[model samples]
Target: MTAISLPSAMEFIWLEADLLDSHDYAAWLALWTATGHYIIPTERDAEDYAAVLNVVYDDQEMREARVKRLQSGLSMSASPAARTVRTVSRFRAMDGAAGVFVVRCAQHIVEYKYDRTRMLAADVLFWLVPAASGISLQRKVVTLINGDDALHGIGYLL
Candidate 1:
């Protein structure tokens, strides 16, 4: 097996962020392998694999369904869609068994409407599986800093 370089891993992360920031949902979904998981935790201490209080959990099918909903104009809240800006910082990498690695980063997302603005800060953990097509996401786990408070709606991608 070939080793995954840090630069390549960072590139994949940058690409993923660009796709999300651009609202290219279909392109974003295509980046995931079939068994990929997306998670946003409601509790900081909760393990993503075992947690029940997730804000969003999606396997491939569920992700596809979400994309379909967005594309079909079924998402009512998208009207005058919320604007979002995200900055990812402080990237750290942890070596996993075999060829996989876990990348951790701090993310700050600012979302706004006409008069309402909300800021979300989170620690994001990504399982990076080295593939022929570069690094594919095995899992994405987000732990919000403000998990205790009621979050305003996230109508767009973070």
Candidate 2:
């Protein structure tokens, strides 16, 4: 198998961000490994997300269900999903296990809805595993800058 490079990892991350900004859930979902986890912790310093109260902690099945709901236009909060533009940058990579690596980046997202605009920033970590296709996301943890504060009106993916 060919080794993945830092530039390639950055490219893949950018693609994922673009897919999210465009609301292309299907394409975005395909970027994950079968056992991939998508986690958003309410506590900025939480180590084990399963033991803590998280804004989101989804596995493959939950992710699929969420995508279905977001695309179905049935849920009130998601029916008119907030438009978002995300910028992911300041990428730093570190090797994890034998074939896995972690990419850490800063993400700033601007969400617009109901004539109001909100800005959310986070430090995101993506654990990536090598795959035949190059790389796939094994885990994603988003630690919001103000995660301990009350947060609402988020109706779409982060």
> Which candidate leads in TM-score?
2
Ten contiguous residues minimizing lDDT sum, candidate 1: 44-53
Q: How much does each candidate deviate from the true structure in C-alpha RMSD? A: 1.8, 1.1
Among residues 3 or more apart in sequence or in different chains, the pairs in candidate 2 whose N, CA or C atoms overlap within 3 Å are none
Best by lDDT: 2
Report how far residue 1 has shifted in candidate 1, in Å: 7.1
RMSD of 1: 1.8
lDDT of 1 by residue, 91-123 (tens): 888767666788888889888887988899988
Let me know the TM-score candidate 2 reaches against the reference structure. Answer: 0.96
Write down the TM-score of every candidate: 0.90, 0.96
Worst 10 residues of 2 by lDDT: 94-103
lDDT against the true structure, per candidate, is 0.78, 0.90
Model 2 / residue 119 / CA error / Å = 0.3
What is the alpha-carbon lDDT for the whole of candidate 1?
A: 0.78
